[model samples]
Target: MRVLWLSSIACNGNTHSFLNYPYMEQFLNDFEFIYHPVIDSNYSLKEIVTETIACDILLIEGSISDEFKRADVPVVDIITKYAKIVKKIVTVGTCATFGGIFRESDYKDTTGLHFVKEVKIDKFKDLLNKTISLSGCPVHPEVLVNTLYAIKKSVDLQLDNFLRPKDYFAYTVHNGCTRNEYFEYKVDNHKFGELEGCMFYDHGCQAPFTHGSCNKILWNEVNSKTRAGLPCMGCTEPTFPKSNLFGTKKNMGIPQDLPLGVGKRTYLTLAGITKAFTIDRLEKKLFDD
Candidate 1:
């Protein structure tokens, strides 16, 4: 019941996401909450390294680095020391579970805390069985809450190849999307903020191919970035923000990436057919100012 939360080389986006949980306060009541970066009952990095706290669970945030220097000490060494005593370890956020955007920089020398881009490290193999990964640009709050609840209750939890819980990531972002109707009819939104057209074709939205339930759960209990005139950006998928996010990928006038299992030829053929029969409603504004 004693949890030791830690972070390294991150902007604290996951912490912010967890704070937005509707039932966060209620859900947290189940655990002792021994330690966290921005919550009750926590310790500083210096205190953690000094072995001042004894914990049963280790929750890591942000990417790991072998050479990351913090106050003249390496964070990787600090985490490994705690990993030795903890019964369970949870890597929160894509940065901690899988090398994220921060890894692009040289100084941080960042990589996932456990498996570095699908490649596992032997140093942490002994603790793999106790490890649970919650990956997202900033992990969804529900994912963290549900995982903790499952562990505390000692219930069986299903996980995928990446060690992520199945319940939350079982479906793609395309599932239950409001713009699904437009996607089915091959309607493409030529510009940002159009509610009636799909963003996959011309706008670089990755909802169809990316996994997660942004559309199903709905962020802030109202809408997601995609639903409110923004694109999915594939924040949950491994290959996120693929080079030059401002534009879509195309190879020979066709989208370089297709929906989950869609064939390139089939997608193009359908797109051509749908483009020929442009509906006036799809082209006209759905809301008036």
Candidate 2:
């Protein structure tokens, strides 16, 4: 398969993150790269913009903008050209999928390839069927690589409303979180760098509501934000880079965003019941300090 990787208004965080993939050398061997910004490839940026290149998969990184140019060629023009022929279009990060952090600058101008923060982009509405979104602050290397292989094997990836592969995005970040028990008991972690309490109550952990395989797959194949005592920032959601990320938005001691499918009343009742009893083990340090 041949891939033409392109970027628009972006920091290239996804590219840097992808370089950390343990199997990158093997992946490069399998896929023929027609043009890549960082990697040495068969073709240069000048050729990609000037000539018609046969590409099977078109990987777009960063958010899109009308003014942003690559090789002095408009990014939208590049996408419009290749989007017509590419078999698949993979938006490889939250920025490319839903405009992410860049959208905060100018919601009208900076936008995703197909959708702008849940709103579909009419210009590329015709290509929605062939587009796949891999939304993350900097998408997990495994998720991107695995999806590519699935595409190679003709696997029909079931996507969600966001056009993200359901196989990876279906699971919530809380699924494999280590502090699930603490969350259930409504124990809030008051301070950072401690593994004793759940961050959902106070530290703005969005694992319970946000969907991703961060906890399941683990970042760098070792630890995740929650595992390291940091909160899940909900970077994969359409409304990423929300204000005051360190503090959970609440309404009179109740969280504004409850766990997925869990009603506010039900959560309040459960929280009251859980708070009635104390789990001595949870209150004590797991190991002697």
Tell me how candidate 1 scores on lDDT.
0.76
- Relative to the true structure, candidate 2 has a C-alpha RMSD (angstroms) of 1.3
lDDT of candidates 1 onward, in order: 0.76, 0.89
lDDT of 2 by residue, 188-273 (tens): 65478786788898889999999899999999989999988888999999989788888989999899999989998899899889
RMSD of each: 2.4, 1.3
Instruction: Name the regions of candidate 2 deviating beyond 4 angstroms.
Output: 106-108
Question: Measured by TM-score, how close is model 1 to the native structure?
Answer: 0.89
Any runs in candidate 1 off by more than 4 Å, and if so which? 42-44, 69-73, 118-123, 272-280, 287-289
Model 2 is weakest, by summed lDDT over 10 consecutive residues, at 187-196
Compute the lDDT of residue 208 as modeled in candidate 1: 80
Q: Summarize candidate 1's per-residue lDDT along 1-289 as a digit string, tens digits.
A: 7777777778899888888989866867766666677786766656677664788778888877877755467777767777888777888888888777776757445677666666766656777788888888988887787788788787778877778777888788888787777778876665774566677777788888877878788887788767775668887765654676656688987878788888988887988888789776766776744
Query: Top model by lDDT, which number?
Result: 2
